[model samples]
Target: MALYFFRISQGRYSGASDQPFEFDSREAAWTEMTAVCSNLLSGISRGLRPNSEWRMEMLDERRKPVFCIRLTADTLD
Candidate 1:
């Protein structure tokens, strides 16, 4: 199983750290949050520019940090 990350900022959600909530895959995460995430992305697209090449570090199966998939505009809070 692969790991994926989801996050929201302080003002974005009633949560801590703004850190990621991990999943086994992007599809899995999206499936669990389809309605909410889709709506948020649609709203953000109305204002913010799309980030086609966003990047971030994440841990792999070996527990070593490595550059993973480029984040989509979907990561926006």
Candidate 2:
């Protein structure tokens, strides 16, 4: 297993988890990112959040960005 980090980036705001999650492959981490994006979109549709530029950056144990999933109001349209 390898460690992975999920970092949130929205406009100028940024946050990250100090603890890492162990996953067998990058695909597993990607699956988690997709779920997170889905939840964020749901929150926007439910009027729980303002639709804006949002994304989750997936980083490897070495702190290198592996991929990013981005979302915006246009995504809902």
Candidate 3:
């Protein structure tokens, strides 16, 4: 399995969530990202809150995309 660094973008907190969490692996990162997004969408669909947006970025010190899995709110919807 490939290793990656995943980061949640800045200023994404909605007063209910945390800011800027990171994952050490792509699979773990995707799992966390999906869970957060699912919760957010569920909240929005139930009229409990407005849609929250977040950006996902993956960086490679070697400038390669072979081991990256970057996803954002826009990518989900």
Candidate 4:
């Protein structure tokens, strides 16, 4: 197993997981990342403003970025 961390950000607000989680495979980490994205989007009403972007960064045990999922929203003016 490997240790990983999830770092999330919404426009100007950003935060990272306080603790590490163990995963047996990279695919498993990706699965969790999607779940986090779903949770964030479920609560998003009109989407993030002033930036309209959100992201989930997956980091390895060494605190290095292994992968990322970024969401961008746009509106027709």
- lDDT of all the models against the reference? 0.44, 0.80, 0.43, 0.84
Flag the better candidate by lDDT, 2 or 3.
2
- Top model by TM-score, which number? 4
Candidate 1 structure quality by residue, lDDT tens digits, 1-77: 56534434322332222344566775665565555455565555465446433323344344444333333554566
Tell me the TM-score of each prediction against the true structure.
0.30, 0.76, 0.34, 0.80
Instruction: List the pairs of residues colliding in candidate 3.
Output: none
Rank order by lDDT, top first? 4, 2, 1, 3
Worst 10 residues of 2 by lDDT: 43-52
- Pairs that collide in candidate 2 are none
Badly placed stretches (over 4 Å) of model 1 are 1-5, 8-28, 50-77
Whole-model alpha-carbon lDDT for candidate 1 = 0.44
Off by over 4 Å in 3: 1-19, 46-77
lDDT score for residue 36 of model 2: 78
Q: What lDDT tens digits, residue by residue, belong to model 4 across residues 1-20?
A: 99999988787898889799
- Candidate 1 C-alpha error for residue 49, in Å: 2.2
Order of candidate numbers by TM-score, starting with the best: 4, 2, 3, 1
Error of 2 at 9 (Å): 0.9
Poorest 10 consecutive residues by lDDT, candidate 4: 42-51
